[model samples]
Target: MKHTIFYILFLATLSICNAQSELVKIEADTTNIRIGEQFEIKISVGETENVIIPKLSKLNGLEVIDSLKTDTLKNTISKKYILTGFDSGAFYVPKQQIFIKNQVYETDSLLINVATVKIDTTKVKKFPIKGIKGEPYQFDDYKNIVLIALLLISIVLTTLYFALKRSKDDQVKTFVPKLAPYQEALRNLKLLDAKLLWQNNKIKPYYSELTTIVRNYIERELHVPALEQTTNQIIESLFDFSDAKVIETERDTIKKLKRLFEQADLVKFAKAKPLAEDITSDRKIAEYIINNMQPILEEENSEVSYSTPVVIVQKPVIEKPNTLAKVVLILVTAAVILILSIGLGKVISMSKTSKNQMENVQ
Candidate 1:
């Protein structure tokens, strides 16, 4: 029993000098302490990587209200331990353990006292709160100039892109839009007439104009390239577009155009003269070409509706001023000449008679 007591006392004394683990330090802001005084206690471990903070036990006569820590970095992880108490008394903070690697270390706890600091109620002082002032600026003229230049360049580039796009759009608008089917056909007919090509013995041009008018109409209204198609191809394409019964009536108009074109080709290329009746037939063919599609022009493209202009000019067979006017003017002029000669002869014969009678009587 005596030996055992001695061994325990030696261990206790060793504990007072050094705790159970590796090297660590515990410190307070002040050694003499008072109650209701709040301060910080720092705990550190030596040559270590990992540190652990166990929940601190409540000190006798001290009430801890709040505690907090700070940011930790990987190389040296430091932690701030803040402790606050409101009760006034003396207290001994127990020893703490800091963990390093896998081993444990001990730190001596600080002892502090809390004594009330008396304040005279009659005296009061105000505490001021401060904020950090903004840093002063140094002027940089070149940087300002560069920034303004970049802004101007960006605006100019953006404006140029839009302006170029608008200009191209305007160009397209300036381009002549495609004429309506009947408008094109009529315009072409007017051009054909202006040439008076028939009088020039250019039957081919006359027939060519008629055929082109018809083909141009087909191409526009039907969306077909009728200009490039043969007569047979035209008929075949029309047939394919609709069943026979519906297009059966249109076949005659198609044939009329085909015949007119063929005959014109013959006169132009083969030097054949057309029958007088064929000329009238060609006019009829033109009428038929436009008449057939007039209803369609009204039905489709309702937004910008199209129409065929009526050709109100005199027909060739009508009594043209050239054909009859010269004959009438000649007959009237010859009658006037005959009347003047007869009157002059009568006056001369009467005068001679009268002279003869007078001579005989004398």
Candidate 2:
């Protein structure tokens, strides 16, 4: 009898353990939720060993927004689901099932309400549409535009500078120095000799050119106004110079020049032609007088001081600007500056006016 009673007690203990493993419970944070709002639904099962959790995607028109992992404390395992609904109405959380060791267990059904958020109409305020004010003008607003304009101006100025410099260079490249007075007179005489004008029946032209050479040479060598003076006037001037001993020349040179001038005046005004022999002889006399009338150098009677080779240094010759070029450059620069100044003034005035208008509107 005692053994039979002990066996029944062991069977009772096994049934109680199986019943505890099949127990499942569910709870929620709130029974009411606003439309589009979320709530949590937590489920707890009594045991984890050999438990097969049921998939619950949707319940009573409410969607499972998110599902958390199952958490275990002692032998109980709990799971939480984040749920939400968009439509406004009452919703029922239907019985959810949990399986353990192939045995099914269920939780109680629950009710929930979804409604729109309530607002007090009497407390709300109505506002009308407002006019937008104008924005204040700022220099930083046009920083890029101003910078670009200044850059362009710099480029134009630089281009003009280089262009004018290059133009000046080209002009300097083509310039030739003029021949001096004595060298020029000598060259003309040689050319006139080559012409042989008297042999070609051009005695008047020959005598005129010969007299011109003699007059120019006298003026250049002696600093006398021989070309502008009459033949008698030139002779008087030369006689004075000789009496003063200013020029170391013979009176015969003056007489020869006066005779050449008289012959030239007769040929040019009276149309008298001279013989070829007279023309040739006159050319020789003109050259001899020029050579003789040239300035003579005086020798210094001082002791020599040269130890090394003496290097004579001449002063640097500074070239002056051509009058016409200076005038043109000044005029052009003034015009450009005037145009730019006017344009800049207008731009500044416009900007100020625009800013004032904007401020007034605001």
Candidate 3:
């Protein structure tokens, strides 16, 4: 029994020694390198659980350029240190400690040799240092500044052109009649009749003008946006007015107006041509509708006078010029000009200085 116990203790000690030997290891990529050359030192641990790598403080004749993070693969954890040396000598990378699951382990030390670069004086010729030389200026040197200045000028000119054109276009003249709305509408009807558009193969224009006059009258007198509304919408607005006791009119009159608008739409869009008698009857119906609505207008606006003369004159509408925009544009233009001038002066001065430098060297 005493012999067996001694043999078991010896086997256990051997296994512990083997585990300590295999746990941590250190290696170098190369033992010899030239001065100012970089190399790597790798530390590998056998165990992967809760391993901590000690910080490397300093190394003699070498610098720790970088330290890579620990990498885990299956059962091993590994890290790498990038080292570079500037001195021509041999250096030893000292041992590093590792902590794994509350147990301490150590890595083996490494050696690296740094060699100086050699030159042979017999094969190489020596020359004296020369003075600085000046090169001639080329267009490519200042091309960017010149191109930028031209682009800015072009943009400013384009903006100014559009602004002036818009200002000119804003000077438009509109004609507004001095006569009352009802009187003006009646006069327009008379003018339309005098034109005899349908008789001269202008049926579309005749119907368009006829409907426009009536719609304008309704809009002005009834305070409804009849001109912007569709035919059905106009009729519905009229019905609403009637329901509110705003205006009293026969349903037949509303239906007649609807029919007239529909016929005009068919003539204009669908290219339907009515008989001359039908056209004349439509004209009479337009007149009847206008006369029918005049009494309602007088009742609503009794204080309005219809004695004003029927004179149409041009009323000019001039938009105020954008003063702030013009100011900003002027400032921008001035700034660009100033920058270009400064850049040009600098280029000319540099060219002169460079020319003098070459002359002096010669």
* Candidate 1 residue runs with Cα over 4 Å from true position: 1-178, 242-249, 294-362
Candidate 2: pairs in clash: none
lDDT tens digits by residue: candidate 1, 1-362: 99999999999988855743334666777755555556776655445345576656646665455565634544444445656556666678887666677676666767777777778877877767554433333345235644655565566556445433323222211224456777778778778878877767766667777777887787777765789987778767765543534332365666666676677668767988776567657867786777674323233545664443443433233333464655655565565556655754775586567666655555
Per TM-score, what order, best first? 3, 2, 1
Q: Tell me the tens digit of each residue's lDDT in model 3 across 180-200.
A: 777878899999999989999
State the lDDT of candidate 2 residue by residue for 1-362, as single tens digits. Answer: 99999999989987865665457877899989998899999888988898877777447668888989989999999999899988889888888778888887777777878988889999999787554455666788667656766776676667556545433322222333445456668888999989988888888888878888888877876788988998899889988888888777888887887787888889889998777777777888888777777544346722323233333434444465567866776676676667667766787788788767766665
lDDT of 1: 0.63
Q: List per-prediction Cα lDDT, in the order shown.
A: 0.63, 0.77, 0.84
Cα error of candidate 3 at position 13, Å: 37
TM-scores for every predicted model: 0.32, 0.38, 0.42
Task: Kindly report which residue stretches of model 3 are placed more than 4 angstroms away from their true locations once superposed.
Answer: 1-140, 143-178, 194-196, 222-259, 296-301, 305-362
**Candidate 2: regions farther than 4 A off:** 1-22, 35-38, 50-56, 59-69, 84-87, 92-110, 133-144, 147-151, 160-362
Evaluate residue 12 in candidate 1 and report its C-alpha lDDT on the 0 to 100 scale. Answer: 96
Clashing pairs in 3: none
Which run of 10 residues does model 3 get worst, by summed lDDT?
166-175
List clash counts for every candidate, in order: 8, 0, 0
